[model samples]
Target: MKFTLNTRKVLEFNRILNPLQNCLRMLVSKHELISLFTLFFLVYNLNMRSIISGDTLPTSLLPFCILEHRCVNLDSFGAYIETINNPYMFRQIDGHYLSQYPIVTPLIITPLYLVTYILLKISSCPIDMFNPSFQSIVLLMEKLSASSIASLSCIFVYLSIKNLTNKKIGIISALIYGFGTDTWTISSQALWQHGTVELLLAAMIYITIKNELLENKLNYVFLGFLSGLYILNRPSDSILALPVILYIFLKMNKENIKWFFALVIISGSFLLIYNIYYFGNFLGGYSSLSDGMELNMEVLSRLVGLLFSPSRGLFIYTPVFLFSVFGYLTIKDLPNEKLRFLLYALGLACILEIMVYSIFFWWWGGHCYGPRYLTGILPVLAIYLGLYMNKVSKEPNRYFKFLIFGLIGVFIIWSLFVQFVGAFYYPMGNWDSKPNVDENPQRLWDWNDTQIMRSFHAGPYAYDSRWILLFHHGFGNIYNKITKISNY
Candidate 1:
């Protein structure tokens, strides 16, 4: 009787599908189906598989950073709070503790923490909130916050490129933005400011593109709000949005300008209030951090290392971005001068971001993977890639088509391999292993032992990939042997 009922349901489902098969085929192309699968592939791996393997702030400091952890109450002593070193929290002048990082990211994900806490309590779980396992729960929350926003960023990339070019180009743009770039390795890994900033930046680009096609006052208002959130997430990386802001300014009339300014002022006012309350300054926590950093020859050297060094270079991690050079060269072929100007302005903004990172003391982006500072500008580069794809598709030569696409395929494979290995396979602190060079006192910069190569060696050597160790001296020994370094 059960078999008969199952057979009837299967037959009914097939009968329904048989009538709609042709309609479904017509509505969804094979290419679109493949593209959607690719989108899901990138999003799932980048988010779910990229959780912390070691020494990540999201795991170690996020609970305290968000004020979720506190000293145990007498009534619930040893049951509710776990006493730990609290490495990332700083005591305020008034004796209250806050994270050294800005509050925007923790604030954004607070509700997730609340929900997780509620679920834990409802289940009558006998877990301490400060146990190492508790961080795993918050990490799940981090994955949801980062991945969901990142998925939205990818969709906006598709929509922006589709409006500017075609669906194929849009799909490729989103893939490149989500997977074939540092956006995958860094932004999708945790609830970092860079990931949130990337989402906001992507939204800004999409809105900017939409406003260009059809002027909308509300768009500018939203852009203003996003700009504020962008700064709050990461103050320095906010430069990534300047091009869009300038483009908006260039197109606005008196009435539109008034609307934009009104929203901008409101957003700015919130930032000021948040800052004054926390850090006793209108500029916020970043104001305390801005002093005593300057540019020099050493800074220039670190900049080169960040861009071209074998281990840390942005291009090495995501080779698909090399197409961005062509993106600049082919601007004349763009549909209009306004779009071309937008590209130029955005390019300058990217350069400005690099310069900002260069001047900073720790140019290597401490304890993370691959040029993490540039995550915000990656969507801009993806647009450039869309332009490159658009240009090559228009060419008439068959050999040129084969050669260009073949090259792109190779680079895309390399990027996917790097990101996948970086997410799940590579040791978190594998690169920071050498003795201090005279040039770098912190031993963070390594030019020859690229992270890709380190990952290859990590598994074979049974390296300490554990997330809990304060330092892995074995990696340092391995680095010395590989780099053949003596006393400097």
Candidate 2:
């Protein structure tokens, strides 16, 4: 009887152990493991250099909307009057009190803030708006939201590429977006407006490439909703999306057109009402050409800087975009007109975004990493780059193969290093200046300061850089300090 019992126990242990071992093997062989690993990597980077206080600007628009739900931020009246800053970024109306930015971000962020507020209240914790604990909670939620959104964008890029091309190209495209670009730094690291824009834009491109609308009319409705959200988020960049929208409408059947139009109208109506209530104008408080708005004749210089400048260039920070140029060269070989038109619309959108940003005096996009204004179009670039990769696969020249792949590998490494620098070092700009007055007046192209490189030097600043965060002190110290401060 004892021997039979022991034999049964041994068999049961093997049964469990075998499955566990097989599971490990399966993870090693499949892309799911890579996906999880990449998500964790993004989460880790986002949580690394978080700020607990004093960084809120545009995001404040959200929490205020939630807590107050008023059209105007009445409290900002004194500051607006005192500042008399640029109307393009922020405006205080003469009769009504309101800020200039759109309400979509606030709409999304408010629910999260409310949930956090309620949880703290339920726990009987003292809630001081400026307290370290409350601020930490808010920042944590923001980081988590941004990182999760960014990760979803990565997944979308991966799926879009995988479905359109092959698994290999898909994985590479996802990894490139996840790490080899400012999406990791600007989009994932904090609640920058770019994070939300990147997420929504990536979703738009993903749905476009997924070609689900051909199968289901409902997809067009969904696309319409996304279109509305895009317009709400950043009206300037919305023009970039017009080509894509037009293509969708042209392709849609007559029956679904009403649904698409209805959704867009609903979104537009909300925007119109919000503007009227706040600014008493349908367009809200926008700066006219007389108030320093015009085509920056410096477009030629701006164009060069946007593509090549070390500090602000899109191609410098995200060199994988170079592949897109190659992809553009091979655009003629695309399998279908639908795919070809998709590329054209996306390309024009990217060019328009870059051009608009370049024409603005604040083209560098204020104290962030790597052409943040252009971040929304990155998914569009990555998808096209995947097509470029597919073309390369068919090319038979070994030397050509080695040259392209070698350049890509080197560029990827360079891009990752720059982002790593961004992740660790403090952004060095005069963030305190009033919105209208160019705070960091130094030209992006002329500015010689490179914080990423400076972090490597031996000095007091180096001691505070990410090198210390990784090597000497460790990330645990950040958590410990937060806990210690919370206790106080």
Candidate 3:
């Protein structure tokens, strides 16, 4: 005899919209879904997919010295860091800047560098193991570097929120910031200064925190040093602190003038030196330099979209963060709260928006969908919005909050999976041979005028009827398979 289902089971069954279940809600039948995963699974089944896939190349080599791996004695930014750790004989003798990469990144990645350096030293391994241009070593270094920055950013986000709210709220904020999809993805890659947004936010928050810096005096002096580095990386970072500067002026009245002057002197010194040293000018590193830039209008347009209305005013970067807009404004329980946060966050957004408009080349989505340069701003934006989402969900049923942010977390995890899988897939020669389909793998590459080949999007190959092409390398028909999956 059939038994009646309980109310609990009924409710559980009704709420069967889990992410795993969602994945199963396919556009095709069960057999077809099996076919699809089977196809994907086969592509990734190869034991050493990453080796065949050239995706890990960037991770293996540093991008300093105008983007070459081992052009010696160029005084490049990366060479600077390597010199510090490895003691390059010629660069030290030459006293050059080409030997160094940006100190900002080296400073951030120091822990990893130091550890890697020590391990190599202790093991008596060659220093090439720590060289950023050494692909295998560099890739490992880059991944560790990315993880460190991500963890650091997560810690800072937690502290920033915790400074403003309760520990519970801080934990919530930290989790969101740490696990948000974009932050996780960007942080997982060996992107440069990708943690700058966190640093920028920290500076903004510190400056905005009433008289914290000015009253403390010494902290303001140090912040000045940071401010210089901050401005050097992205001038727009300075704008993030303006609201706090204005707050000090308004609150401290006449006394704030000294504070402002001191702040300016400190920030100016670094920028002054950066310009003098990098480009042999005190005020014209990027502000006045114009040369062979591949300025693309489309890339610039997308860069402007980070906070513009077309991006739904920042929600596109973090869809789960749509709720954060209100929390960001409302969390400031005092007039100062609203004044400082709205002005600082919004102020930073405004300046970044302007810079995006002004700069044409060196932008993302020009060649890749995930713009590498803008990643510096992405973490903070994601953290700010993610924290806001967590905050709002508190008033609603905690379960609902959990459900919403939980889904957000799930989405973030999915994105993370994509990044993680993508991160390692190419180096592994990923492939699957389960479907029993036989086809030449030559379609994966496109011949160019320069004689050097590159991968083309799958559809173009299919349209051109070159899916099989001539000689294939690793996998058979991966391009067609991926293109077909993407079409759906």
TM-score of each: 0.78, 0.78, 0.55
Q: Which stretches in model 2 have alpha-carbon errors above 4 Å?
A: 1-47, 51-61, 64-99, 111-114, 126-128, 212-214, 283-292, 428-443, 446-448, 455-488
Q: What is the lDDT of residue 484 in candidate 2?
A: 71
Q: Candidate order by lDDT, highest to lowest?
A: 1, 2, 3
Q: Candidate 3's residue-wise lDDT over 137-250, tens digit each?
A: 444456555555556565556555555554566656555555443444444454444455555555555444534423566445555555555655544344554554555555
Candidate 2 Cα deviation (angstroms), residue 150: 1.6
Local distance difference test values of all predictions, in order = 0.66, 0.66, 0.43
Cα error of candidate 2 at position 433, Å: 10
Error of 2 at 409 (Å): 0.3
Q: For model 2, how does the per-residue alpha-carbon lDDT over 1-488 read when each residue is reduced to its tens digit?
A: 99999999999999999999998878766767465556645554543555322233445434644564444353533343344344334555565445556666666667666765555554444443344454355455666666766787787788778877888898888888878887787777776656677777777777776664355766667777877877767766787668667766667567777777777777678877877776676655542422443475677777777787666788888887889877866767767677677777778778888877777766666555567778888887888888788888777998898888888888889988777666655343422132222464444554455444543232221232443333344334444655676898
Q: Report the error of model 3 at residue 364, Å.
A: 2.7
Residue 122, model 3, lDDT: 39
Model 3 clash count equals 32
Please tell me which model should have the higher TM-score, number 2 or number 3.
Answer: 2
- Name the lDDT of candidate 3: 0.43
